[model samples]
Target: MALILHDVTFEMVPTEVRLLTAMTPAGFPSPAQDDMEEPIDLASWLIDHPAASYVMRVSGHSMVGAGVADGDMVVVSRAVEARSGDIVVALVHGDRTMKRLRRRGDRMWLVPEAEGLPAIIVDEDVEIWGVVVALARRYRT
Candidate 1:
């Protein structure tokens, strides 16, 4: 399962979010105010380097504890160097997998956040695709 990065570029269409001046509490229903701030570009805020970033849909519950849920879209940076404790997409023996990178001395480990799953020890041949920078989720379709 080799995941290849397709050479693709597109115009950045930013989603504008309404900035509220006051914090609305979910526990208590408060009267909505008409106070409006400048619209913020979520694409600019989420992506630091758009040229090096790509989005992919996640699968399975391997990374639930790390805030990455199934069907969530994750922003991955191919140009970013993956470090220890960073969640990354990697090719382990031709199989693409998402896991947290862990390093101890000369050994590397791909750790899963879900319980009952075993961590994988990195072999001699491994290709790290990118580091997961941000996650996007939808509450309702």
Candidate 2:
């Protein structure tokens, strides 16, 4: 799938949201808390090196096994060096794609997390664009 990238623009003043001190449990019911912690700046918390990061909306199921789904937004960071096993946004033969980066000795490959998808051997035509820093998803409109 072709990657659709959106530039991240931050406001001059950061927006702070109230943060709860309690951690919500996923497996069992937990006691709720009325306590409020210090407000958090989501943009700062989510995006490290804001000047070198951008957001891209995912458009394929190739990364479903990695917990990244179609329609999710991933924050890509160019400031971070792409490493082996890193989920990266890359330009493959001039086409952009998001995949897991794998390295074996001197060779590298772009591997998909889903079944039946072919892994692409990294060649001179491929360029690692950025490393995936964070993911964002909305359950409802």
Candidate 3:
């Protein structure tokens, strides 16, 4: 049998945290679909913070090139800033999805990598949920 390995790290910091009001489905605009996902148990899957955090299983093949395939779990950092080349969770027309971010003329656009897909143009109706900080994928036989 072949052994599979992953890197591990540790960081220490203060316990206090600043809070941000979460934007809900009602607040999402220009979404592709209205689907609410079932939340996952964080402790068993990821590192837990004392403050509030949520996890969503990624769906769709739009981000397949980036390795964020359908049913992969992406860890979103609500605390991180969205940069030009970072992957993000966004609400478009009330639909939540994972996408890569890019800057346009004073605006940001969400680009999907799956072939035969059109980019979700971000407008006044779109909201960036959070920046995708980590991704975990499991191989299957």
Maximum-lDDT candidate: 2
Task: Residues 13-63, candidate 2: write the lDDT tens digits.
Answer: 588999865655564434565477799988778886777888778876778
Sorted on TM-score, best first, the list reads 2, 1, 3
Candidate 1: where are CA atoms >4 Å away?
1-11, 21-35
Tens digit of lDDT per residue, candidate 1, span 93-139? Answer: 88778889999788888887877778788777677888999877898
Against the true structure, what is each candidate's TM-score? 0.75, 0.82, 0.59
Q: What TM-score does structure 3 among the candidates reach?
A: 0.59
Single out the weakest 10-residue window by summed lDDT for candidate 2. Answer: 3-12
| Candidate 2 backbone overlaps, count | 0
**Per-model lDDT:** 0.77, 0.82, 0.63
What would the per-residue lDDT of candidate 3 be over residues 32-97, giving only the tens digit for each residue? 443444444434345344233345566566677877766666667677678988988787787676
- Residue pairs clashing in model 2 are none
Give the residue spans of candidate 3 off by over 4 A.
1-52
- Model 1 is weakest, by summed lDDT over 10 consecutive residues, at 1-10
Candidate ranking under lDDT, highest first, comes to: 2, 1, 3
What total of clashing residue pairs does each candidate reach?
Answer: 0, 0, 6
